[model samples]
Target chain A: MSEHNDTFFIGWSNDISAGLRRFLMRAAAFVVVGLCVVSALLALSITDPARSLFGANAAPDIPLDVTLRGVLSSEPYPFLLTVGDAARPAGHGVLLSGDGKHAAVIDRAALGGQVVEVKGLLLKRGALDMLVLSESPRVLQNIQPAAPAAPVPMGRWRVVGEICDGKCGAGIMSPGTGIAHKACASLCLIGGVPPVLVLTHPLEGRQFLMIADSQGRALDRGVLRFVGMRVAMEGEVERRGDVVLIKVDTGKLRRL
Target chain B: MSSYKAVTWNRNKLIYDAVAIAAVVLYIQVYRHFGAMAGRDGIAPDDATLSMKAFGSCAFVLLSGILSIGPLARLDRRFLPLLYNRRHLGVLTCTVAAGHVASVLSWYFAYSDLPPLRALLVADTSVAQLAGFAFVILGVGAFVILLVLAATSHDFWLAFLGPRVWKAIHMAVYGAYALVFGHIAFGALQDARSPALAIMCALSAATLVVLHLLAGRKGAVEDGQFAPTAATTPWVVACDIGEIREGRGFVVKLPDGEPVAIFRHEGRLSAVSNLCAHQNGPLGEGRLVDGCITCPWHGFQYRLEDGCSPPPFTERISTYRLMLDGGRVLLDPRPNPPGTRVSAVVIPQAHQTPVNETSAP
Candidate 1:
């Protein structure tokens, strides 16, 4: 019975040679200390100045004073001036009045799809572009309703991407997507930042596109549920110049 | 109870805590500073957000390390020193976690149309989403648990709540750990392209699981083997009378799974429950101080005969009957009701085994 009591202590010390035990202890201590030092160094060295974890897809914000004639759409957030022969999402801008405060509100329901010339600062972030209004647009002659161009079908494809507000997703904020930024992204999208579908892979010449319904109308509250999630969307893609517009069926959006 | 209450400050503990906290702060600052320097295309530099992420990550790491210590200490006695001041580590971890929560609230939800708290709660109520409820909510849940545990870490709360209640409450750290794990898994790691973060997270989780499993297995094995044989009668041969040192105890597991501490004090043999009333610390691991059994954990004392703390202290533990037959000391399997006075058994000089003994009084 007394000998059994000694087994506890004896079992603990007898498992390993003292020299080997000392060596292993020292080695473990060294590894642990080394890991700590390395972690510290890595933490100190890894900086995300631009928050560009995805890709170098940011386009330089070229300041422009040029006035342009284009159609203004109010639905998926206000943006002006379409590039190329067709109305492709060229640059998104806010309608600012003389006082510089956002012109209380632009009656997008009435004026949407109407061609007008406006002047403002051209802010470009990646493929998404925006114009800060310098003054109210001079109602340019509304082009006689041209026969709606035949829907140029690019191709129906499945792509996985995050649904984020164009303003922040286009490098306005570092890491503008993900659960941490989900609430903020929802606010931005709700606040009328053009909701853009950033594709995980470039299909055709477009990696980013203005997300709209099947009819190319702005999807406002319908997309709130999918914001900040990587979702697989089967949508028809239409390319006009550098912009690709994805016409998605809201019911078909699948969370990846 | 010893009518003395001294300040709890220990120089070694203070130094250790200072170094740990300083290291955490330094690591976070350095990581944020460096990460900000490496600019990504298009994204504007927001130092506030960067600092938030840095501190948040550091807090997570600290929490992982803190949780790992329990299993580590169980696996190796050398790690016991780490256990003594673990409350300080937990408090510091909570402080860092609070910093993370504060930064997120200020930067992410501050400018929202709704109040910050409301916005955080209602941000994304879509339970159907793959990302789960706003990860912020998970983080908040974890933070609240940590706050509660940290606030109640002192001995006053332990005494007020009692050891069982206090231990149950503190076990909520596991709940916090689960919440934080969800917070990270769905939040930061959602759209993360870097595998480094994923690997680190997996490693931290694996280390915790493996260490706990190993320690638990070892403990189960020890508990199983501690008892030599089932007693046909009430008296079980605990050990040789000589095996116990003066003023110290030889702990033996009864057939019914209760541990009995057979103590040799003032040339007499007495038995009490090995478990201390406060915190359930092993009383057998402690020694007699001024003729009363002192608990190794919180200095809770019980008289050798009655297993009751002296006057002004109402703590009581179950006492057991002990007897000496020849060279062997036998402990009665049945425990007398707690605080019951049981007479001590004396070993005759002729039956005392010849063995070298150290006095622990």
Candidate 2:
């Protein structure tokens, strides 16, 4: 009787061990499969719309076409239009001609510091504004050669800003001005995307300013290296109708 | 399994390939549709950029799946089917990645004043920036490695390069994976505001680590339990003769964690390394086909007596000395040089004893 009892206990223990091993194997398989399923689902679930991910600030819904009399400064690549009183230090934005279909060719240097009447679409984001010119700006009046309006009191100030291509920076690409975007920004700038200086702080109702050389000329290829970097530059700050122009000395541009 | 020509198309493999392709297409289409729908309000990206993002993200997801299949199969034999035709998966991953590269080049770099390739190289040389240009270089490096692996995934290339060289080349996949991780981390993720992507990457990495650790631990434990008790002697008790059936093998792990496969055939036993010389497939999992030990992976064969592939094929695997003590089988832990001829240990009972019916332990 005692021998039978010992055999029964042994058999029972063996069965228990086999059951436990089977359970563990099943559990392991379950865990592995579960992890794979969950991971795949997670990957699928996290994919945001490309627009939201890449194009954060898109074009405005309602396009406004208006004519404004402003001062035009051509130091930067794409000319800037300072609306209202140029001496008041406010309301400046990018001056672009023609519709989105074709690139407009306007010799900005020939029309620097002249009060002009421009007709274009008014694109605004926050305090930053871009006036897409439908036609050539008609010079309403020129700064008198004698008085010169004291050169609008050009103040030499140091400011930090990222240099990015204007078209994408305005509404095309979200967070477009960064190291990751440096290469794309360079490409766009080279392809004539109007290099725009995005200021770290809002200056007189403008966060973006067109960048150019000290003599109010379009920047050369030397600025390509500083495309996506936040750099400090001592530049003469001038505003014309929601557009700010920074005449940066190429030699003084220091990467911050 | 030893056919010398192209891959034989079968129903199961055909179905698997079709399903995989369809799944990828469906995933991309669905994501694009939903993504576009979600972006109806004020943030609609242009179709070109949208398509690029769709293809790029699709390829990334496919790559993640391709990487996960290996560890998943190790954890569960049910996942083994995924491993059997993994070369197809790799090729598909390369194709998808190529699509992504195409879209990026065309949309972003094509119209640039510089040539596309030159643009990619010289556009952003900012090494000190937060999203430095190095990420693009890393991406290119990973893509190149993937391209090589995909191009050489055929059996012809496997035979030409030999298994050892082929395996070393394939191992570069891990390096590519590391580069890709850096590419995404520093590139797209730099501006990513959502936590979902970050969490998914972390989970995938953790899953791979855990699976590999568990698989390694299981092998280590098995080796530890049956390691030779006497360290001074080279001989270790492998198992009883009854543990291996005729024309089959019983795998035993040596003290150093090398698995040796002991095969029983015609009242004789021989031992060889469990790792196949080609692709490192488990020889023990394969059967004796035409008296040669066939590898389960690619049907690479070696003679049981000398651990050498037949002439015209010079691949060799290390063999061990086996001794039968009464009914118990003992294996010498020390391996004979590759291709060295070693005599088999003959059982004493010979033809008088019937083969055991019990399965291998």
Candidate 3:
């Protein structure tokens, strides 16, 4: 049998030929190296750098609590007007969402002119800020409602970018926008998370805006279906403090 | 090689499983760590998302690797070692795929009104939308098939269901593979900012298709050689007696596409079905060891005389009658009842089979 030096494999027997063992070792090494290279390439190439707050305090962490004292506004979706301290000079308008996918639970008429302290977990990124409300805000007795900056209407403008839920965009979900995040974003929007227009190219140096209908309410089904997808739309662009707001024309919203 | 129904663990199996596990770990680790480094603007994606991609990519790599082994073994005998204990590799792949499903359910499908699994099934109802249609359904289909394959991978199931039925069931791996390809093409590929998933999917499909084509070409060439004699007589001349090596088989392809393995052992020739009873492996590719034909795929041994696996192993394959008409070796096209003994045909001294050196174990 040794005359031809024929090598065959037997799975039940451990008496493998020395040559086969060496060959297998080499094969294994080659396979492992190939797999690692492919894996790294796949992981590297598909990477999206968008940040999220889900991990390490950026997201819906169970044990995170933040308090902000601000004037509650309901003109363009529910927002908290915070007085920035020394660390944050430019005062902020924070978007708010409820515990789950719902928007922050607040009576719009009662809180329109009230100064209050809002408590929630913050999802912050760039100019995007969202407070996932722990409960109803505490209306402060002593704090006076400060007159924040007036909205500067920037006329009719055409814009392009993805439509994402405000909460996820601020930091709740990393890579919180895109077709991959579409279903979740749709659920969020349907469940009352405020929708926003994340611009493809920053218009007037702003990448995001709290987007709503002409009535300043959540977008209807026609626009919400485009969530997590890039869309081009015409909206009334207005600058409010460090943040931006847009009143989108439903007829002009087209998926990009 | 085993009588009982359990994983037939051996040194080779241990080594094979260890290498498979290491490969999976290395792939996932490399993906998770390098995915961050590969990100743009010095920012990494969320941990949940990164982990999901890591497991997802690792499962793809493993499934691709697993599918490649069969054609590779067919093309080159050196790769047969990979074929040994391949079920473990299959089980590992399913486990990794399960991890991917879990990650998606926990992170993306969670915190919603619908239950995670139900949401996974019903999340994307846009079946007509090409870009982001119901790709999850394809993934679910593939996962179910993988689950079935993994569940029935035991030898007991093989024995219980019998080889033909088991093989027919396992053939659904290709269907699962098709579903997986569609799942990636429509699902992940749509949102991937880069074409990595597309490129990877293309390469995997190309490799499997090209390798199978090459192996099929080889099979066609061999099967074509002996088919012309089928119309003339039932006793087709397979080859010259000397064409078969000592202690090895020369496959004779009948016109109907069935092959019979004719082995030269102890200065005589014996014939058995070319298909192994286990996994329908190519028995003609195997060689004789200790007076029995050992299937190269999993080492299921059957005596050449009766085509019966030795006493403890209750498996059998059909045997055939061989005739030495002078120097020409002719074979009967019809297969005898499995495990029926047929006496080996002795070669005359002029064609004496090399002093019986192969008789020694």
Residues A1-256, model 1: lDDT tens digits: 1222211111111233455445445634653564456355544333332233244554345445657666665544455545334444443333222211122146777666676677766545555565656666655674642332343567877788878766555444555556567777776655555677777765564556677888888775777778877788888877533446688898888877
lDDT of 2 by residue, B196-274 (tens): 6677667667876787788777655433245464333678888877767787667888878788898877778899988
List, residue by residue over A1-256, the lDDT tens digit for candidate 2: 2112111111111222344345435644553454345434433343222222222343433447777765665544555545546332434455463443123456566666666777787655444455667788777654442222333544877877788776556554443456556677777766655777777665564566777788877777778777765678888877544446688888878877
lDDT values, one for every candidate: 0.66, 0.65, 0.78
Candidate 3: tens digits of C-alpha lDDT, residues A1-256: 3422346878787677788888889999998898899988887886442332122222223224788877788765788877666535535788888976677889989987688888989877666778889889888988777765678888878787788888777767767777767777777876778887777766676767788786556677676456666678876767776667778877677766
Residues B22-113 of candidate 3 have per-residue lDDT tens digits of 98889889988887773554456777888888887777778888888988987888899898888899899999999988988888788877
Top candidate on lDDT is 3
**Which CAPRI quality tier does the interface of model 3 achieve?**
acceptable
Give the higher-TM-score candidate: 2 or 3.
3
For candidate 1, lDDT tens digit of each residue in B182-210?
88888777655556567778888999999
Model 3 interface RMSD, one decimal:
3.5
Lowest lDDT 10-mer window, candidate 2 chain A?
A: A3-12
* Candidate 3 collision pairs: A53-A58, A53-A59, A53-A171, A54-A59
Report the lDDT of model 3 for residue B51.
Answer: 83
Candidate 1 regions off by >4 Å?
Answer: A1-71, A82-105, A109-124, A130-158, A220-222, A237-243, B1-7, B39-45, B126-137, B221-237, B242-248, B265-267, B287-294, B298-316, B333-343, B350-361
